[model samples]
Target: MSWTHTFTNLCDWYTHLLHNSPTGTIHIHILRNTITSNPDNVEHILKTRFDNYPKGKPFSTILDDRLGKGIFNVDGDYWKFQRKMASLELGSVVIRSYAFETVMDEIQTRLIPVMASKAHGENGTEIKTVLDLQDILRRFSFDINCKLSFGLDPGCLLPSLPVSNLADAFDLTSKLSAERAMNVSPMIWKMKRFFNVGSEKKLREAVNVVSNSANEIIKQRREMGFATRKDLLSRFMGLINNDDIYLRDIVISFLLAGRDTIAAGLTGFFSLLSKNPRVEEMIRKELNQVLGPDQESPTFDQLRQMHYLNATVHESLRLFPPVQFDSKHAEEDDVLPDGTIVKKGSRVTYHPYAMGRMKKIWGPDCLEFNPERWLKDGLFVQQDPFKYPVFQAGPRVCLGKDLALMNMKSVVAALVPRFDIRVVEPHHEPQFVPGLTTTFRGGLPVKVIEKKMLST
Candidate 1:
C-alpha cells in the first residue's frame, strides 16, 4: 500500500490484517511475503532458526549501490566480519567513553544552544519559537554521527543551520533505494535502473554524491594515519586490510546507523511528551532525584540512574520504531513457530510497528503510551527481544545500540528541564515518509518555550 492510497496507514492496516488472522501471520502469494506480528514467529525467525533467514541476494542487491559491502547490505562473512569488528570497537571502554563524551559535548555546546536561541522571545515578549523538531534533531544527529564515524563535524546543527550535501545525498539515496523495494515488481525498478532514467537516475546521482563524500573521508583518514585515532573509521581501518572502498562502506554503514534512527526516536519521544504531561512530570521528578536542579550538566553515570527516562525512550520507540518493519528472506522452505509454512525464497517480515500496537502481546492498554509498562518497582525491565525487536536481536543485533540510547537519553536529560516542546497538532497522527527509517512528514512542527519563561 502506497502512502497516497492508504494515507500512510499501511502499518495500521497490516496490524488490522494480522489481528484478524488466526495465527497473526499472513502470506500474500502475489508479493511472496510472509508478514507476521506474532512473537513466537518473530522469535523463531530471528533467533531460533537464524541461519534460515538472511539478508539474501534479493535484499542485499537493493542496497548494494549505496551501502556497498557494508554490514547491513550483506550476509555471511561480510556481515560477520563487520559485525565482529564493530562489536569489538563498541564493546571497548575507550569507545563507550568516547561516545558519551562526544554526545555530552555536542548536547551541551551545539544542540542546547540552538534550541535556546530559537526559544528566546523577541524584545522579551512571551512568544514561543516555532521549530521543526524532527529536522533539528536529524541535523543534530547528523553532526554527532559525522563525529562518531569520521571525527569530523559538518556543522549541520550550527546556529546558521547550514545544509550538508553529504547528509542530503544520503537521505535521498536511502529514500530512493527503499522506493525500489516498494515497486510492485522487481523488474520495474530494475529495468528503470538498466535504462538509467527517472527516479532511478536521481537515485544514482544521489548515491554518487554520498559515495564520493564517503571516499574522500576515507582517503583523508588514511593520509592522516588512523593508527592513533579512536573514531569508528580509524578502528575499522586498523581491522580491515587497507581496502579504502571497503573502509568507505564501513564508515557509511555507521553513518546510516548513527544518523536517522536516534533522531526519529527522539522526535517521537518529545511528541508523546507533549501529549502526556504526566509522563513528563514523572520524568522530571526522576531527574530531580537523580540530578539536583542546580547541577545542570549530567555525567554519564548520572544518566545511567535515570530509569524512568530510559523507560520513556523505550515507550516512544515501541510506538514509533525507526525501522517499522524488517524483512529477512527465507533461505529454504521452513515452517514457522506459528505453523505457517514459508516457501523457499519468500520474504519473512516481522512488523515491529504493528507488534507494538498488538493487544495480544502488550495487553488491553497496548495502544496507549505508557512508560510504566517497562518499569517494575520503579526500575526499567527488559522485554523479550523478539517482542520488542526495536534494536533487533540475536547475532545481528544493532552494534551501536548502547551508543544510540546514551545519546537519546543525553539529549532529553539536557533539554527536558530547560525547555518545553509542544507539538503544534498533538491530535494528528504523523504521516510517515517512505524510507528506510520511519521519518514523519512535515518535519514535526512545534512551538518551543523556555521552561523558565513557562514557569513565570
Candidate 2:
C-alpha cells in the first residue's frame, strides 16, 4: 500500500495499520490504547452510548494541570454547565457577527497587507523567496483569538510581526502535555511532575507563564470595566460569578480553541492549494461568480452561500483535522456497535486522522485531496458527524464550528483574490509535530505572489 512508505506521516502510518486490521481497530498495548477508525465504533463512543464514555478521570488528569477545569478538560456537571453557557454565548447571533467582523478586520488590516508587502518586497525589488507562511498565519490567528477572547491586541500579527510570550508558552505547554499523553506509561511522566525535573519542569514553567499572563488580561478587563465589552472574556466575566482562576480557564479555553485550529486549517488548505493550482483557479473562479462587482470581500451571508469554497475548506479539514484523534474512557465494560470490546477504565480513541483516509469510510480515493467529494448537484452537502467527527459529534460537537468556518472562509475570500501562495515544497508531505492541534514539522515555507485585480 502507498501508506507503507509514509512512515514519517504519523496519521498515514496509523491509517496503514488500521487498513491491515480486519476490524478497523488496533490495540497499542504499550500506549494502553484501543484505537479505532470504524465509523460505527466512533458513533458508539461519541453518540449512541456517550454516557458510558465521558472523558474519565484518567483521561482528564493528563490535561488537567494545563487546561485546569476549562470546558475542554472537564466532565459531568462541570462539562455540562460550561457547555450550556458557551453554547448560549457562541450561538448568539450578536457574538457570531462580532467574531466575523473581527476576522475580516484582521485579514484586511494585517494579513493582506503583510502579504502585499512580502510580494512587493523591500527596496522596490519584487523579491521572490520563501516566507514562513505558517508563522504568519499562526500570528494572525493568535491576534484574532486574543481580540475575541480577551479584548487585547497582542500585536503579534502587525507588520513587524512581534512575538508574544503567552503564545510561545502555550505552544510549549501544549507540546509537553501532548507528549505526556503519548507516553507508554503515566508513571514516568507522573514521577517527573512530582520531582519537578526535565520536561515536566519545563511544562510547569510554561504553564506558570500562561497563568500569569491570563491574570494580567483579567486584571486589565476588570480595571477597564467589562460592562459594554462584547468580547468573550468580558461577557464571561460579567456573566459568571466564579473565582478568578475558573474565569481565566474559561477564556483561555476560548483562546486555545480559536487560535491553533484556524491556523492549522488555513495552513493545510493553502498547502494543498499550492500543490493543486487547478483547485486554486476553480476557487478564484467561484469567487468571481459569487461576489458582485465593487465587492472586495464577501459579507457573512454571501460567504455562507459559496458552496465551492465551503467544500474546499471541508476537504482540507478532512485530511488535516486540527485535533487528529480524541479519546473517552469507559466508565463500565461495554461493547461498541462494531463489537469492539471495551474494558472499564480503558482509553478508547476514535482517530479522525485515520478515518479520513479509510477506504471503506470515504471510498478508494480517500487519500486524494478532492473537494468534489463534498459537493452534490452544484452545492456542498454535509457529511454525517460520525464519519467526519473532526469537529467531534453528538453532545460535544464544537461550539465554534460556524465561527471557525467563517474565519477561514473570510480569510480565503479576502486573500485568495489578491494573493497567490506557492508552497516552497509542494510535493513534500509534512511530518506533523506532536501537539494538541496539527502543526507542520518545519513550518510551511511559501512564496506569495500578489495578484493584480482589474479596476472596475
Candidate 3:
C-alpha cells in the first residue's frame, strides 16, 4: 500500500476517536496523545493559552536525545534564549543577503547543473525517478544553511553526492524522532536506554556526530573571526562567551529548523509547478516583469514585488505544509469551544495540513491549487498569518520566513525561465512522504525542456 494510504487510514482512525472523545486531547494507541483538528481550538491552545503549553517530555525526550538541548526540544528560558539568538543573527540584512546569494550560488553552481546534465543525456526523454528531489533539495538546503549557520560550507551538493556525515547524523536523528513521535512505550524507551539498544546507540552516535561538527565549526569561527563576513557563525562566535550551552543550542536549533522545512516547501512548490504549467508561466511572467528581462538574481524588494509568486508559494504551502502537525502540551486546564476540556498536562495538535483542506477556514475550494484565493482583484493580498498557518502563527512564527522566501524565489527565478517542467508520473496527484516534513513520496520526476529564448 502507498504511504498516503497508511497515513489516511491512520488519520481516519485518529479523527474518529478524537471526534467521539469528550476531551480535546486523546491518548492514541500509537502516539501518546493527539489534539483534534479544530481551528478555533488550535488558536486558543497555541495562542490564547500559549503559556500553558510547552514542548513536553514525550516530544522532548526523543528529539533531545538526538538534537541535544536545542530549541525544538527545550522549553521556557532555553527556548527563549535560543530563539532570541537565532532571530538576532537570522533577521539581520547582511545575513539575509548572504543567505540569498549562497542559495543562488548553490542553484546555479550545483543544482541546475545536475538537471541540465540529466536533461541533455536523456535526449529530451523524461528523467524518470529523480528518486528523492527532497533528498537533493535537502542537500542543497543543508549546504547553504551550513554556510549561513557555521561560516563554512559542508559541500553536501558535490558531484558524487558524497555521504554527508552531518546529513547522515540528521537522518538517524530524524528517524528516531519519528519513532518517538508515535509515542512508543515509555517502559521500552527506558529499558532501551538502560540496555543501550541498537537504536539508542545509533541515536547517541548521530548526536555526537552533529555536536562534534557544530563544535568544530564553532571552534573554527572563533579562531578565524568575522573580519569580513557577517554570517550567523560570526554572530554566534561573537557571543560564545555568553554561555557555551546556549551557543551549542543555537547551532543545533538552526540546523534542525533550516534543513528540512525549506526543502519540503520547495519540493511541493516544484511538484505543483510541474503539474500546473499555467502557474509556472504566471510565475515566470511575474519574475520577468518585476525583475526585468535580464533575469537577474532577485533583490529583497524584487522578491517582495513578485506578489503572484508569493501567492503561488502560499498556495503550495497551504496544501503541503512542511511541518504538517505541530504539537504542544497544555500547562493548565483549559476548555475548548467544542466543550472538550484539555487537562493541564494534556497534549494538543494543530494540523495546518488538515486546516488547508477544511472548507470552513479556506473556503469551499480548499483542496484546489488556486493561487487566486491569495490574490484579490488582480493584486496579491497577504492573508492573515493565522489563517495560513504555513509558517505558523502568533509569537512562535517561523524566524526564517523572509530567508525561505528569498531562497525559493532565487531558485525559481533561476530555473523557470530556462526550463519547462513536465510531471512524469501521476499528474495532478500529490504523493505524501511523511517525515519531519511532508514531501513527495517517490520524488517529483519531471522532464525539463530547455526553454527557447526569444529574440528581443
Candidate 4:
C-alpha cells in the first residue's frame, strides 16, 4: 500500500494485523520499519529497553531545518533543557492568568460562532462539509499560542482567512512536518532537501513564514518595552537576551506543540458525538445537571463536575487517539517481552488506536463506542496512564495535556449543551489520516441546532 493510503487507513491495517498475526507483532518496512500490535513489546521498547532507543539521526535530520534545536525535534541535553524551560514557563502565574483566559475567550467568541454559522443558512437547510471547523480550531490554537508566548495576538481568530504570516505558515508547516517525519533515511532526506523534492520546498517556505512571524512578534514586543507584560515571550526574553535564534526556536516549538493536535482532537470528539447519540445525550445531560437548567457559560469548577462529559471525551480519544502512533528508538540492543530483539538503531512504534481496540486490554466490547466503559458503578473511573497512553506514557508525555483537556471541556460544555449537532447528508464515514496527529480525510460535517431548555 502507498504511504499516503497508509496515512489514511492505518487503523484498518492494525485491525488486520490484530486478527491475522499469530503473535500480534510485525516487522514491517514501508514508510519506515515499524514494530506494532504488541503492547508488552511497545512498553519494553519505550521503558525497560529505553536506553537502546534514541530518536536517531534520521528523525532529527527531517525536522532540523525547520525546528532547529527545539524540544519535540531534538533529543539528549538539548531536549532536556527545552523541556525544563517549557515546564517552568508554563507553570508561571502570568501564563496561568492571561494565557488560559485568552484561549477561553477565543473558543467562546470565535470558534463556536464559526461552527454554528456554518451548520445553518437563511434557508435553514444544512450548508454541510463545514471545512472550516478544523481550520478555525487551528487558527484558534495558533492565536492562543501567539498571545501566550509573545504577548501578541496574531488575530487569526478574527472572522476571515488568516492574514498573519505566522498563521499561514503554521498551516503548511504542520503538513510538511508529517511528510518529513515519514521518511526513514538521512541521505534520502538530504536528497529531498538538496533537490527541493517532496515536501521540502513547502517545509522551507513554512519555516520562513513561522520564522518571520516569530521575529515580528519578538520585534514588536521589544519595541513596546515589554516590561509591563508577563507573558511567555517576556519570560523567555529574560532568559536569553536578544538572540533571534532562541526567540524563533521557542515560538516555533510552541506553535508545533500547540497546533493541529487539539484541532484533530476536537475533530474526533465531535465526529464521535455525531455518530453516537447515547454518548452525546449523556454528555449533554451531565452538562445540564452540573450547570443547571438556565446556565450558559460554565465556570471551570462546573466543567470539572461533568463526569460523563469527561468519559465521552476519554472514549473518543481512546478510539481515535490524537497522536495515534508514536515511535521510540531503542538506544542499544534489547529483548522485548515477546522475544523479539530490538536492534540498537531500530524504530519501534506503539499504536494507541490499536491498543484502544484490543479485546484483551479493553474487553470484548472494545470496538464499540461506549463511554460508560470508563465509569465504575455510578461514577467515572480513571484508567491507568500506562495502559491508556493517549497522552502517551513515560517521561516524554505531552506537556499541554491538562490545558488541552481544559480547553476541550470548556468548548464541549458550551457547545454541546446549547447546540444539537446532526451529521449532514450523504454522510461520509470518518476515516483516519495519520502522520504526527490523527485527522479525518475530509473534515467532519454536522448541522447544529440551538437546543431549547424548559421555560425559564
RMSD of candidates 1 onward, in order: 2.1, 2.7, 3.4, 3.2
Best by TM-score: 1
Local distance difference test scores for all models: 0.88, 0.88, 0.72, 0.71
In the range 254-274, model 3's lDDT, one tens digit per residue, is 777787788888888888777
Q: Write the per-residue lDDT of candidate 1 for residues 290-355, one digit (tens) a residue.
A: 888689877888888999999999999999998999999998899998789988999999999999
Q: For candidate 4, write residues 88-141 as lDDT tens digits.
A: 877666666665677678877887776665554334554444453555666777
TM-score of each: 0.96, 0.95, 0.89, 0.89
Error of 4 at 197 (Å): 5.1
Candidate 4 colliding pairs: 51-331, 52-330, 52-331, 52-332, 53-329, 53-330, 53-331
Identify the superior model by TM-score, candidate 1 or candidate 2: 1
Steric clash pairs (candidate 3): 31-182, 52-331
Model 4 worst lDDT run, 10 consecutive residues? 121-130
Across 313-373, the per-residue lDDT of candidate 2 in tens digits comes to 9999998898899988898999877677788888899999899988899999998889999
Better of 1 and 3 by lDDT: 1
For model 1, state the Cα shift of residue 75 in Å: 0.7
User: What are the runs in model 4 whose C-alpha is more than 4 Å off?
Assistant: 2-8, 29-32, 119-132, 161-165, 183-186, 425-427, 452-456
Clashes of each: 0, 0, 2, 7
